[model samples]
Target: MKTLKRLIILTTLLSLLSISLPASTLKASPPHKNVILLIMDGTNSDILTLSRWYRGTDLQLDEILVGGVRTYSDQSAITDSAAAGSAMATGVKTKADYISMNPDGHPVLTVLEGAKLSGYKTGIVSTSPVQHATPAAFTSHTLSRDEFGDIGEQQVYQGLDVVLGGGAAWLKPQVKDHTKDDDGMLKTKQFSREDGENLVTEIGASGYDLILNRDELLRKGKSSKLWGVFAAEDISYELDRKALKPAEPSLSEMTHAAIARLSQGEKGFFLMVEGSKVDWAAHKNDPVGMISEVLSFDDAVGEVLDFARKDGNTMVVAVTDHGNSGLTLGNQGTNENYKSLPAEKFIEPLKKAKLTVKGATSQLKKDRSNLKEVVSSYGLGNLSSGEYRTMKDAKSMDDLESEMVKLMSKRANLGFTTNGHTGEDVFLYAYGPGRPSGLIENTDIPLVISEYMGFSLKTGKFADWYVNGEKFYRDMGFLVEIEGRTSNNPVMVAKKEDEVLRFPENKNFYWRNDEKVGLKSVNLYDGDTFYVHVEE
Candidate 1:
């Protein structure tokens, strides 16, 4: 009788607690040891069909199709990468170009940051520069995606286990070479950072093995920390890389390498891999480049899925940030006989091309007199008189490349409505223990991952660790000023009686009256406020 009375009291207390809390707060599940998030940036759902047709087989993504995500920003119907990526990184929607900041302009903890706080290894891989919007949103908190210098520095101090992508140029400030190009004009390669701080040196000092080329990345052995920057900027598109054969590594190669390094940790890991250039190709309405990128991303997906299946304790989730270019398989030309038309008409035209429009344009001379020969040589065949004239009168390199791809797309029956992002739901794919299914909001992605990893983003020590530097000091009666607002380096200075604290913008260590104090996470300046992790 006493045991039955105790059970009744326990049930009554649980019912009362459930009524007091929100459903989201009550949701919980078993945690996975590892999770891999693959994002094909700016890919439309239809591109999967195009990829399937191009390969004559179903994709690794097709097998794990779970649901869809509603892609939109806090204020706009169509979301840019920064906002979309931020929504995925943090479980909140913000303005375009914002990274990990909420609509209220406050820095929020990301899933990766939360994972790090929970003692899990973390990494980010992308075909674009690692400091680009998608990857930056996960690892750093900033007001603008254009602030590559701040983002890059924060990432270095963020203590990520593995970071593999392009953008080595951002780590070092711009330096004039006083050299001339092939046209006898002075060539100036301007880097993005204004601080004059060489981060590559700092990365090495921080106990990371710096890898600059594909061979170095491939030959890398097991290590706790790895930083590989493949190119000066965004890596080449797959088709363009196939033609040019640059020394950069492919997305899958980087993913494979990151997993190899991250798996060495005992606490498990959270890895985000992005096929970053599909959006660029879609913005130009280049179908061939889009197809090539989608295929390349699928190859990376295959690598992730293989690992997840083998490990059994890992979860793999793949999705796109938003739709772009409104790519369709059939255009108005096929309207008359849509059902009767064979796949050969579409597949054959794309097969004839060996290089992307960008690659083909690179072969053009200064005068562009070899446009026809270059176009024909890339397998587009002899251009018509009207097509040649259209490309000949193009205003800029961008225009020339767009026109060339447009002409090729017309022959391939690929239709693109606009060169901008579209407001639409993107397909979601997942595989693992406790994978999310059914329709979900874009912001729910990180929440699902948080649940899968057994962490609480809504209420946790992660948020408490990062305090607003100015507010925290000001409340303690110290005078504070965030210096260098416009420059790449911003320092938070707090002054009190016979004591002062100097927190440099992106470094993990701060100074308290000549003594350096280290933090577990980096100090961040998000254009308006500075965030620093304070130990309890």
Candidate 2:
């Protein structure tokens, strides 16, 4: 409440958005267009504030704190990521393991599917495997989120405009290695799906451009349908990802690319971007890792906000599915009379961990590996005998990582009650058109988006207006023209060579002649050369 109170008091926080059209204007049934929903899975208000404070970066999401949302699952108050995300995606309560379905196991349409059906382009991006619960709920449906193979099948067959994330193992082929110890270290790993279809290959065969690394992502064709998978499973946690694999794009980069591709269409778009590993880090109770992940997620939120600020019609929703591990700043500090303490000291020791707990634990499974040396690298050499055994003999990666994180928590003076989600409501923020107001139920999420579309646009019509190089102002009324070629001009938007421009005002016509005269643009890429005049 302290941090939230600060946010409420700060005038700058609420200044991110102008007031929406008056209540009277909304009665006209004016259609709302683009929407971007960003979920930081398994996060709570504690992580949000600490990340903003420790990282020292000005996250734009902090300036738009709208309210909080209750996160109870259909069957229980203690909601897992799958159920919480499903509630948001489908506007219905669901069982703990379900994805995009009602509690009765019936397939419920998601806002993404609604957008697709209504002719709006759809996309999803995540730091975890795309088949993971958070991202899965938006575009795929199943009684269980564990159905990774099934989820991957729909990810391709559904033919979204853009899909980017890790979790390539679900869609691609893999061979098992039995030679290694079977202590559940995934030593014998295989990923070829049971259906025998390699969706990664099929994605390219189906005319979608498949990208595997950061460079390819940035250089991907704007006109090409895109499917980019950065890692085999979860993208490495932010703490060690860049240092270990520089080629993989960050969360913000993926968000930017997904928007770039999806926004190519005139019908508008619905995109869900998840900073998924925040929950994983939280589940392990690794405050340092959690902070970095939160900051990373917030960076992506900043990207979406940047786009929304420029494109007046877009709405941005930022929320966390639930809280995790019951993290607090410090037990030594209390209300009102709390002593000022050194947050940097705690944050600095976390810097010693070069790899995520999961990554470091995997490195220790080798024959000559010294657990002491491995733990020491993360400032955890003081583990007790029982704690040491718990770490060394961890039955699964989750156990191994959680045990290691517990050890690290002691040194940092941070306390964690459990290794799973807590029942607490989490922070939810919004800005721009169709923003959710006040405190809301988690199930109200999809409805907020659904209602914003106002009515389904069968033809995906947008009132696109062209500017003839003079001054133009954008309100929340329509889709306006993009950039000219002038470097200093704010009106100049980057144009791709193979772009197919849609002019909805002219019977939603597809304009594709770049070098042809009388067209709005040409191959020479000169904004002034080809100008379309307005007839009044």
Candidate 3:
């Protein structure tokens, strides 16, 4: 009788507590130990917003904003990945297409290097090849982003504790993309270094446990020094990873593996993870592909956060370099009447797609007869009447492929201003120590990390005095040599507009007086010439 009475009393107390408490309550956020910097290449603030609307849920970034970053290159309002990545790596912005170097071609120290300086291990993971701009920015310095061979070589000697991604061809080489031998079957691509040295052999010799596939990566997770190469160029986008032959590791898997390997360091480590294909997908305005990349990146971010939360000393940062395709949310389509973008119309078709437009194009190029079948297999469907005519008249396969991508863009409700980077600011997110509270430049990122780690780093300027490029400046109605004019001696201009168009002073624009060029005070024409006379 006494035991029965006690049990009834305990059950009554539990029921009362459940009824009194609300279903949801806030929890404390995580602390820092190591710093994991995640760069979502070529994504936009608007794209993030659109993603939330489509999914009908908060993207989780809603709760993790550290601040925002203005992403401009040293000499232009728009920045490519190379310059943007360079600015984040070393707090200095270089000329467009340059990686980890000043205009003088000197190497700049990166946050990863700083980590190494303090005996902290370092790792870099990307969807792109390891030698791609973002990863190269942390490990190698080169005058041109196109110098893949040089970039690959320099990365080999960086003493990196963990490096994983695609681009085996850059480190090695290949005879031909689709060369054939005496056999009926296609020849297997071989690794060919110009000097006849194998990078794979050399990397293995340096004490790294080389992993070439997903199974290898997972089975060999405890390696102190690990290297993984999964694709000839970039690994497959997360949306298409299901069909990837030889099975590549997903971004989250790589992140977890990298952390496992690097966490063994006596001092904390620094790691950079790039959702690089996000830019590639955005460049083509493939909403479906871009979102897959974004989701994959988010998965990686979650993995990093989990590690950071457990360690209590890791600083996890998430940011994008800049906007691409000028992505905006709305009913942007071929329809005459504008309606709010129906998320289902875009989602259902893409979900049915077997290949990205890029993949379909490559397939069509290999066999012209397969064009119809390939089109049917993907979301692109049949070509437009004009597109079919243009494809017939096209002189080269490259031109035909370009037209296909455009058609694919139209099929989706997404509209693209340009297939390139834009001069827009991107959002920054953090969940650890020293997270900033307001707007910041791309260069300030490293400075913040350096401060938290008690290290000194060089900081990049706002790059307000740039003239875009020589050709661009000329197109902007300037008739002078690049070196002939300086910011102090600004480029002056006269046009039908009332106000004088100048440079540097309005810095955000190539030509501005007191306001934007199209505004009433500053109208500009194609042939108008600008000059600046700084009279004392």
Candidate 4:
């Protein structure tokens, strides 16, 4: 009887020890430290291959591919912005058309929210409207991705640390200019609909310093938050925007600015930067435009890579949601001049002339002999007289685009299908800590990030949990004490009941709101717990 009782006690003690030890103590080290997700919307794999061929050397992306992974989702092959971005933001795959909402229209938790709960600062930057699909997925949970107005409103309430890029008009109320419309219907229509307060004003009121231009963004400031808007809609493409605003910051500039601001947090941060126009150019089946956009996006990638290399712990990922316009390399042409034309020459003259295909063709006929010279210069010498006549009558941009395709096809061996998305799988590149050693699917993105951040998925629901330090625990449920040290030194304690507590300089921690009384030291203790109270 005595032996049996002793055995039972031993078993109970062993069980308690197992419960107290962390699961990681028996496992391998966790992967990455910080993660930076870069979305290149509507970019296709062919663009990378073509770019390599055109440059006559391998690109930096080729090196990244060696350490990266590529995998598709179980969702629709040709995914829309909302669906694709949501899948990348969250681990689970949902049906097409849902943004951050679940299949049943219920709101789903995103990695951004998860990171915030984990005590990390969060930010989003994009060339598109800050409320646009890709950025929206990380921050807002909306049933309809088309709810731009709602998304814009949610951005303000979320208290995100940083927001940059265009879409200013979406945040401000729409003002109807009756005189500009040249019609009286403006008076009868509901003209003064409130689209919520100006995003700049709301963000300012929420504690961010508003910076409208590049200079302010680069200038050092003490504010913990930042909001910048450069245009009313999506910022113009790199080539076009530079011609318009020489001082306007490029995508790389915006990315660097975001990182600089968010990295202030002691617990680390999560940021999303997007190059959105790659899809727009692909949608038009404009090879020059698409290639230019891809290269511009690559420059931004270089910026992030540089930062990650210095930080050592920052994980950087570059990927596209889906392919567009089924671009293909076609049969070789006989015209030597066609093969000799520089890639820029084919597109620059057309843009410079500002002559629509119909207008250019019409103007060409007025000077009939000049038509051959102009067309031949573009390497479209094979264009028939009938084709020129048809082009002359073209009435709209679409018609001109069609004629331009035909003419360019004769000179350059290239082919494109309908000007829309395709079902092809896009490429993904990842570097830095926490990434697996092999290729991974799109679903693996959220999982890898969550794991690296030390957060676990509970029934695929991450809405309520937060991560702190190397552990992902539930959010502070009822105001428990929080404490941290800067240099991992032994925590100091008060020597006397009336003596002031002194904290070491440069330590980082947060205390309860009510315990923020005057302090002799930076550190203060409430009852048995030491904390450093900080403003949210």
Instruction: Give residue 361's lDDT in candidate 4 (0 to 100).
Output: 34
Better of 1 and 3 by lDDT: 1
Error of 1 at 382 (Å): 2.5
Q: Could you give candidate 1's per-residue lDDT for residues 1-536 as a string of tens digits?
A: 99999999999999999899898678864444898999999999777787788899999899999999999999999999999999999889899999998887778889998998888999999999899999999998888898888899889988999999988878886633233333224467666467888888889988898998889999956467999988878888888886675687888899999999888877789999999989988998887788889999999999998888888989888999999999988898888878976778788888777877666676667776787776775567777788888977887777777777878888888898999999999999999987888899889989889888889787767645578889999999999998887776779999999998999998889999999998887888777888887777
Question: Which runs of model 1 end up more than 4 angstroms from their true locations?
Answer: 1-32, 175-188, 463-465
* Over 4 Å off, model 3: 1-32, 53-56, 173-191, 330-336, 339-341, 362-367, 381-405, 459-536
Report the poorest 10 consecutive residues by lDDT, candidate 4.
177-186
Scored by Cα lDDT, where does model 4 land?
A: 0.64
What's the C-alpha lDDT at position 355 in model 3? 65
Q: How accurate is candidate 1 locally (lDDT)?
A: 0.86
The alpha-carbon deviation from the true structure for residue 135 of candidate 3, after best TM-score superposition, in angstroms, is 0.5
TM-score of 3: 0.73
Report the Cα RMSD per candidate.
Answer: 8.3, 17.5, 17.0, 15.7
* lDDT (CA) per prediction: 0.86, 0.72, 0.71, 0.64
Q: Model 2 — which ten-residue stretch has the worst lDDT?
A: 516-525
Considering TM-score, which of the candidate structures 1 and 3 is the better prediction for this target? Answer: 1
Q: lDDT by residue for model 4 over 1-536, one digit each (tens)? A: 99999999999999998899898886767433567888888877777666556555666555576333343434665677787788878865666666665564545567786787677888998988887888988887666677666577667666778888876766666632212111111232222215334555667777887877878778877898888887666776675555545556789889989888888877788898889987887776666556656767788888888888898889777888777888765434434545565555433333332222322333243324565554443335555779778755566435645676566644446667768887776666778887644556666777778788878544543543221211211132222223333322324322233333333221333222324333211232222333332223
Candidate 2 residue lDDT tens string, 1-536:
99988987685555533355465664665444899999988887777767776666756777889888999998998998889888898788889998866775555666787777667888999999999998888877666789787677766766688899998888766734332342423355666776566666778877877888999999958454789988878787876677767888999999999998988877688999999988888777888778878888888988998899999999899998988988876654334323655676456566667766755655565542577776765657667889778877876556666677866775665667777889987777999987996889998888888778754312222112123322221232233455423431213222245443432111111243353223221111122321222322
Worst ten in a row by lDDT for model 3: 518-527
By lDDT, the best candidate is: 1
